[model samples]
Structures are given as structure tokens and as C-alpha cells.
Target: MVQKAAAILMIIILTLTAGMAGRQENEKEQPFLVQITEDDPSIAYVLVRMPNPVGLLPLPTEGEYTRTIRQIMPDGSEAVNVLHLTPEGFWMEAANCKGQDCVGEGMVTLENREERVLWNMVVCLPHQLVAELITREEALAMIGQ
Candidate 1:
């Protein structure tokens, strides 16, 4: 009889454990998509979503504007015109990480699948911050917004 009682207790414990594990899994799967929308005409809204707990960060959106942001200079090297794109337009600026590799990045008007894959890819120079736009899905899962 005592053995029977012990067996039942073990089963109950296992069930509870399983239930808790399932809940955890569900929570982990909840946040997986982030959406960046055009908020104020002056400022763009970058909405990020991630699993519960991970929060979102508001990035500053003020930089230089130029048609030839990233370009191939007369020298065989590259040149980046450190420009930050906002709802208003692109800002003409320069990053500290001089050189031309980033400038050779060409122009990124809209984010393509290839660009999205390159999210979080940027070389922060002492004077400039080069960045790429993350996809909605990636942003969601990244920030848990």
C-alpha cells in the first residue's frame, strides 16, 4: 500500500514538472517578430519584439544626408558618407571608422532579404555609427517588443 502511494506521488510530481516545462516553452516561443514603422513624420518608429523579458531600445535617428552615401572613391579603396536615414530623409555625416569598405556598401534605400540578413552589421568608428535595418521578424525576436 505504501508503495502504491509512493507511485502515485511520483506521477503527480512528474505531471507538475511537465506542465511547468510546457509553460516555459510557450513563453520562449511567444516573441519572435519586430516591426519598424514610420512613426512621426520627423522621427521613425523602430518597434522591436522578442521573447518575454527582453525589452526594446530606442535608437537615435539624426545623421547626415547625401545621394552618394557609400561610394567608390578615385582611389581603389571605399568611402562611406556616414548618413542616417530617417522619415524626413538621409543625413550627410561621417563615421570615425574611416576607409572605403563601408562606403562601398552602396546605397541601401530599402531593406531587401539580403540586407535583412545583414542586420546588426556595422563598424562603429570613433566618429560614426553605420547600421542596417533589421527585418520585422528579426526585430521582433531580437527585442521582444
Candidate 2:
């Protein structure tokens, strides 16, 4: 009976320890300062601004992910844009615009979490599309929050 009790105690301790470790890992992940999205990338972005455009919806600077968006802007214009998120930064892979200006905007990323490196814009006025790197503070401001 004693041996069985000891094993149960050990299992309980191990489970608790694992749970604590997982909580710590979760704490390390901070909230996103910026978001790239089709819903609302945020109008507060100063580097590039458009009334209402679409495509290439991405969310924050996180793990590797790819997204393709086709947005119909307020002007009835449309665009298809592709976006990529890398550990190094965010980049534009493709954009269905006449000038293809957004395609050349390249990657906009940070050297470190606090470091500001790239603040560029990829906009195609004809298609009413705009993609740009905006600070977290700027993003919050655009929505009036």
C-alpha cells in the first residue's frame, strides 16, 4: 500500500510541474503590437493609408504563415494580395495590381521587438489597395481606441 501511495504522489507532483511549466511558456508570449488583417489592418497606420482596401491579410509578426486576400474597397475596386510572415520579417509575395508597386515594397520587419527597422508601404492606387508597416501605437490610434 505504501509503494502504491508513493507512486501516486510522484505522478501528482509531475503533473503539477508540467502544468506550471506550460503556464510560464504562455506568459512569455506578449500581445501583438501590430496586426495585418483584411478585417481591419487599422487606419492608424501612418506610413500607408487608404480609405478601405483589401488583400494580404496577416496578423502580427509571429510564426511563419501565408495569406492571400481579395478585398473590394469602398471605391468598388478590387485587388488580390499575398503576404508572408517570417521570423526575420513580413514581406509581400504577390499583388494583383496594374503597376505591381506593392510587390516591390519588400519585407518590413524589426531587428528586435523594440527595434524599428523597416517602415515601408506597398500601395496600388488603381486597385485601391494599401499595405504598410505601422507601429503598434499607430495601429491602436487609427481605430479611435
Candidate 3:
């Protein structure tokens, strides 16, 4: 009876350990998406799915890159914004719009999205541009993929 009980306990322990490991692996496999939308007649749209890191270490830093979004305002003027993107997060690098509030919105990342004032979105009111970090499901639905 004692040996049977010990064997059962060991099996349960192994099962639980395996379950935890699978959960961690699934979390690491999950990926996030970034969407940039410009609400103007020109209507610029961009959707980027960031790649998941391999193992525990990050997917290496490539020094950061920028995507320029341009829109034509109703007043016949052009609005421009440069968005800085990375595997970990993104932020508004520069903008030609007035007020400069979008640049102050700062980076949005998976880890800090909940704590951020704007959550997952950075808005440029003057330029009518919005950059948001969203889940894969939401992104797929948006693009009808």
C-alpha cells in the first residue's frame, strides 16, 4: 500500500510539472500586433505582428526602426508622423503636427500596456493618427484575416 501511494504521488508531481511547463511555453509563444491608423481621406493603415522571442532571451535588438505615416488634412495641408517600432514596444519618434502631444505619449509594450494612461494606444489629435498595440485575435478580425 505504501509503495502504491508513493508511485501515485510521483505521477501527480510529474503531471503538474509538465502542465506548468506547457503553460509557460504557450505564454512565450503568444504574439502581439501593432496597428497604425490615420483617420483622413488619404487613410493610411498599417498592421505589424511582432515576432515572439526564442527561449527566455529577447529576439535581439536591431537598433530600432521608423515607419512614416502621412495624411492629407482637410485644410489641404499634409500631416506626418514617424513611428519608432521594436520587437518589445513602439513609440512616436517624430511628427510634423502641432502640439507634439503624440511624441510625449511614450512607448507602449505588452508588459506595461495595462498600467499606461492611454493603455495600448498612442493618439495624435492634431494629425488624427492613432497607433495601437492589440492582440492577435483583434488584429485578425480587423484585417478580416
Q: Rate the local accuracy (lDDT) of all candidates.
A: 0.36, 0.49, 0.55
Global lDDT for candidate 2?
0.49
63-113: candidate 1 lDDT, tens digit per residue: 432222222233534333334444332222453244645544443333442
Q: In terms of TM-score, how similar is model 3 to the real structure?
A: 0.56
User: Which lDDT tens digits does candidate 2 get at residues 1-145?
Assistant: 8577556545533543444454434433221232345565333232322323211233433456655444444565645666665545556688777778767766665443244233455555665545665554555555445
Scored by lDDT, the top model is 3
Better of 2 and 3 by lDDT: 3
Give the higher-TM-score candidate: 1 or 3.
3
Point out where model 2 deviates above 4 Å: 1-50, 53-61, 72-78, 111-119
Q: Which candidate is the best by TM-score?
A: 3
Per model, how many backbone clashes are there? 21, 2, 0
- The TM-score values for the models, in the order shown, are 0.31, 0.47, 0.56
TM-score of predicted structure 2:
0.47
> What's model 3's lDDT at 57?
14
Error of 2 at 101 (Å): 2.3
Return the clash pairs for model 2, or none: 36-58, 44-142
